[model samples]
Target: MRSATSKARFPILLLTLLVSISAAAGEKLTALQLFQAKRYAEAQIAYEQLAAADPGNAETHFHLGLLALRRNATDTAIAELERAVALDGKNSDYFAQLGSAYGAAAQAAGLFSKAGLARKCRVALEKAVELDPDNLDAREGLVAFYRQAPAFVGGGIEKAYAEAEEIKNRDVLAGSLLLAQLATGEKKYDAAFATLDRVLADHPDAYLALYAYGRIAAESGLRLDVGERHLRRCLELPPPARAPAHAAVQWRLGLIAEKRPDLPAARAAYAAALELDPAFSPARDALARLPKP
Candidate 1:
């Protein structure tokens, strides 16, 4: 009897193991994972498949919309995001991304369509902020809108400053960076410089801050020597962060060196950038333009 019972349990265990393996095989990754990995093409394909299988899935539509936006397919993005909103109107992130899509679409639209699209962008962004005040990205989007749009529309520089203050409460460095951007946009270079200096003084090894400072200083010709140092420091940052920006840093340093009359250094920098990103057009252009040493 005991031998018979043991034999019976063997089949049940096998069945359980097979079920687990099958479930594992069938598991689907969340769309956000693909999006965060910057695999927009793959994510779009996955989302398209998902939306076809589950026609009422708002998240699938929303992710498709995001992928379309990334690819600058404004019309498709609008259609997908509208469907997402219809299915899940309360999703603040969907509205925020939709707002961004509309904003981009407005840039190239005809005069007749431009005004209407801008209005839609403003309204969607506002709704996103209202729905989730804690969402830093949404707030930043609204701030950008406010800073860029004319006073005739639903945007004001004062409103942007107020939002900047709110951001400061959460992230001091981010707020300062925004403030610098605002000043730069307004052509208040001195003010922007002060803000960048403050950030670097506090966080000397801040990779992003250093990169921004270098780019600005180099482009503006404010302090080419100092800018070179900052760019070098940015390159020194270890791995992960450094790898993604390697080509960019090298290109910017090339530009600075070319303008500073250091032709050899400029050529070397451009060559380095090209070695990393073979198709980097800016570096190629700069390298071609340089006089041979």
Candidate 2:
């Protein structure tokens, strides 16, 4: 009788252990499935439950952080993501998410806020790259963060240019366009023109680049003839049928005409832009400022 009782108790203990392991695994699987499905709210709840049950589960905390981010709960996301990174110090993804959370918080704090928040975001993103240099998403996020930040706070034409160059191997045209934008921002008219020329040389029919070149030429006041030619070429490109390139080209033409004080031509171009895009505020504003003929 004693032996049989002991045997029964041993089986009960084994069964309890198995059940606990199964429950934990099941919760984790459910959390992953919900996350993959983009059911962020549900995933958050599931992850929170799992986190409570297994307080040391870094993956659970990471998922919760990501879910909070999806819901735009920036503060909560930051806390959870920071905790996730703390628990799993080697994960680049965790650090990248934390950086994104900091960036969102800084953006919410308004443009005039202190540089500390932006710097924190920058550091976090940099650390993410240090941990995983091939993280494309982190690289892109860093690029965007630096681009939007003020020049006084570690953001400038040089930084933008470097970031663009870093990604040029993957997308030459995009990198060249970005470089041109940085050059234009810095008032480096010659450099901007050169960058645009390189892009156009490789892809002659790139309507977007042509349009950008036209604007850069018109604004820089260095090469009106070249600017006008680019603008006209942009207009001559075959339409993509669903894009607003036509409206954009008309707007650019109006801008050139306005610069030349050709009121009649400016008015015509603005009218064409508005015809294509009724909600184009710039064209409407330009039309309002024009002298009545």
Model 2 CA lDDT for position 132: 86
For model 2, the superposed segments whose C-alpha errors exceed 4 Å read 1-73, 80-94, 110-113, 131-137, 140-157, 235-245
- How big is the positional error of residue 47 in model 2, measured in Å on the Cα after superposition? 9.6
lDDT of 2 by residue, 1-293 (tens): 56988988998999999999998898899889988998877887888889888888888888888888888898899889889998999999999989998888898886556477788888889899899877766777777877778776677555666777876666776677777877788798899999888888989887767877888876766676677788888778876554447777788787788787688988999999899889988888988988899
Worst 10 residues of 1 by lDDT: 23-32
Q: What tens-digit string does per-residue lDDT give for candidate 1 at 132-200?
A: 887788889888989887776677898998888788678877787788778777877788788888888
Task: Evaluate residue 235 in candidate 2 and report its C-alpha lDDT on the 0 to 100 scale.
Answer: 77
TM-score, per-candidate, Cα-based: 0.80, 0.66
lDDT of 2: 0.82
| Best model per lDDT | 1
